[model samples]
Target: MVMGYVSGAVVFLVGLLGGVGLGIACRQYWVEKRNRQTREQAASVIAEARKEAETIKKEAILQAKDTLFQMKAEFERESKESRKEFQNLEKRLLQKEENLDKKSEALDKRETTIGKREKLILQQEKEIGDKEKELDAIMDEQRRRLENLSGISSQEAKEMLIRMVENEARHEAALMVKKIETEARETSDKKAKNIIALAIQRYAGDYVAEKTVSVVNLPNEEMKGRIIGREGRNIRAIEASTGIDLIIDDTPEAVILSGYNPIRREVARVSLERLISDGRIHPARIEEIVEKVNLEVENSIREAGEQAAFDVGVHGIHPEIIKLLGKLKYRTSYAQNVLQHSREVAFLCGIMAAELGLNEKHAKRAGLLHDIGKAIDHEMEGPHAIIGADLAKRYGESHVIVHSIAAHHEDVPAEDILAILVQAADALSGARPGARKELLETYVRRLEDLERIASSFSGINKAYAIQAGRELRIIVESDMVSDSEVVLLSRDIAKKIESELSYPGQIKVTVIRETRAVEYAR
Candidate 1:
């Protein structure tokens, strides 16, 4: 048993040693496998890292190259701009130099021309001064020579020559005047009479006297009350608004308006007609119609004046003067319309001026304005001529024209031909027969009857009107009456007419004494 135990222990010990060697071998193999795996992993990670670093370095180098290229392009463009600006500045400087050269050349030419002109003027002035001194010496020599040759001194000779010339001039002027007077009588008088008679005979116009009162034709007796209105409120409104007095009396279908102002009467006439037509004759309506018609009548008056001026060939007259002239349309002088008389005067003046070789325009203007003073003569206190002259001066007429107007009535001295022409034309127009009518026909009849009374004497034959029927020209028998007896008959006829006549102004008692003894030579 002891032997067997030792052998088995030996066997066990060998087995144990072999097993330990195998275990050690297995452990070494496992460790070697793990170390190999770690080495391979580390190699793979190092390869990946080196590849990423190479790509990053390549990107950085490409970015740097692009940046350098862009910087070079910017520098090239900036250099080109700087070169262009420098070239422009060089061109401008060259042009300025060229302009300066041109200005310098112009200045030199102007200075040269000025110097030449100045020298030429100086030479001319010197020559003129020397000539003037020579002329003065010549004039002095001539004066000395003339004084020695003449008998008297220079001043005494001059006076004698002037006196002799004056005497000769006066003698020649007197002879010319005598010749002109003789020639004028032979040619002028027959021509003047023919022209005046022809003009008067050609133009025959009707004369209507426009009174200050206008009559309104009413519809019926009741219509008059309608115009008067309730309690005469209509009439009162018309008079107060129109400044016209309404005369509503017992006369049926006829109302008379009595007013000194014709334009006011005309206004009331129109307003009453309008009210009668409209059938609304209350105070308010009456006031409205009166105002409207008043304006219309005023316009009518202005138009009439304008027409009168146009018809008479007058121009540049004041509107106020025209209005006053229109007012004269209603005024009567010797029962004839004053405005018509003025128009006739203007026409007559124009005709006379044409025959007399005077200015027709100026003559007509004076005649038209001559009685322009008569338009306001009623309001004024004086002879119409002087008042008219004052009005003309106030209205900016020429002094000569005003003088002509004033001197027409001999109120002022007429020193000019124009004044005398106006006076003569005025007299010819006013003094014509049938040119104006008297206030009453009885007055005209009384003058006619007086002339007839003179003709009733035995020696008178062929009684006729002379000087606007003012003076009677009675043809007497030259066989029966002597020159002294004819003068006595004219005085006796004048004394008889003066007792029978009622005249406003003085009438001339003209006794034309003429004795023509009839004898025939066979």
Candidate 2:
């Protein structure tokens, strides 16, 4: 029974194994068939793709060729049109050239005709000149014959007539000139007085005491000794640093800083004040304070200058120029602060310019900067007017301002009314009563110079500077100078006086040329 069961089981197991093996073989066959089908589909797809590519390539090539043919046709058509245009243009240009050639030939002919006409005109002019010369000779011969018949030599007759005419003309001209001068003086003097009086009445300024040196007040008189220090070392250090002399005298609570250089004196005064205020009297402290105060003072100077310019309504001034103007505060001219003088000049200029119907602001600006050179006149080597003009120009001042400043003293001749106004204002300000004083030596020298200048001119018999050297009366030999010549002589004398001497205002120059018949009186 077990053997039958084992055989049945083996038969069942073999059948099961054979069935599994057959199923595996069939599955492999199906997979291989499916792979073959896929390969075939892929090959067919590749063939179709190649065919489509070839068709597309052929279509593209055909289109390209068609486009090329169209382009060639268009190029040919454009070339044809361009050739036609070129030929037409060339033909027109040739025609124009021909016309131009013809016009040129015609112009050449006209030029030749003009040249002939000019030659003919020149020939006619020469003939006319020849005829004129012939006529002149004939007239001269006739005139000589007429003079001989009249029993008068040509020179003697001319002299007699000229003398008679000169006598009449001299009397008439003198009368006219004197009348015109008198009228002009009458009108001008009245107008001038009015303007000057009006300006003076309008502007009023307080008198300020001018100080050439600055004084720094100390806390006590004992502090003065400390400033002197051991062996006067402190004072020496300050002088060396500032180029100023510190005078620690018995004056209570006061130390005087003296220097010809206003800028140096100002710097020294500031430094000393700082030192006294800080209570540090050592050399190092002195130097530090000095340097700091100097910088501060420099800034103050610049601000003061800028403020002055602003106050006067001037602009475009350089910072350096502003600093220079600030230095004028320490400058004194004739016991008046130069800065104040400049301000006064500026005000006077504005008033004068307004009255004269000129550019008032520009005039005021020029006046304000006119004496700027006084700030550094001691350091520089030239007239303050010229130096100031140069500084104004360098500081970007207008050409008009520079001109007016330069011409304030007539140093370069007044170019405009503004320049003349600047001069007049400056003269008025400086020449006012008690504004300036003249040294006796300078006054005498100036008078001598005036007389010498008048005497140097020809036709001057006696030259005297009268009226406290304000008036120059020059006498000319009556035979040498006529009345008109006397007027001219006065002008020349005035010009020479201006050139020679530096005086306050305008000087009166009188040239007297008088003739007297002394025999009848005897």
**Model 2, residue 447: what's the lDDT?**
83
TM-score of 2: 0.44
Best by TM-score: 1
Clashing pairs in 1: 334-437
Query: How many clashes in candidate 2?
Result: 0
| Candidate 2 C-alpha lDDT tens digits along 1-522 | 999999999999999999999999999999999999999999999999999999999999999999999999999999999999999999999999999999999999999999999999999999999999999999999989989899988888999999999998898798658656766887678668855643332222321123445788878888988998889888888888887877677788998776566677778987887788788798878887788878987888888888888888888878888888888876666566778788889999999899888888888888899998877765667777898999888878889999999888767977778898889889777765456554456677878898899889888899998987879898899888888777777877776665556665468998887888755554
Residue 143 local lDDT, model 2: 88
TM-score each candidate: 0.47, 0.44
Clashes of each: 1, 0
* Stretch of 10 with least lDDT, candidate 2: 200-209
lDDT of 1: 0.75
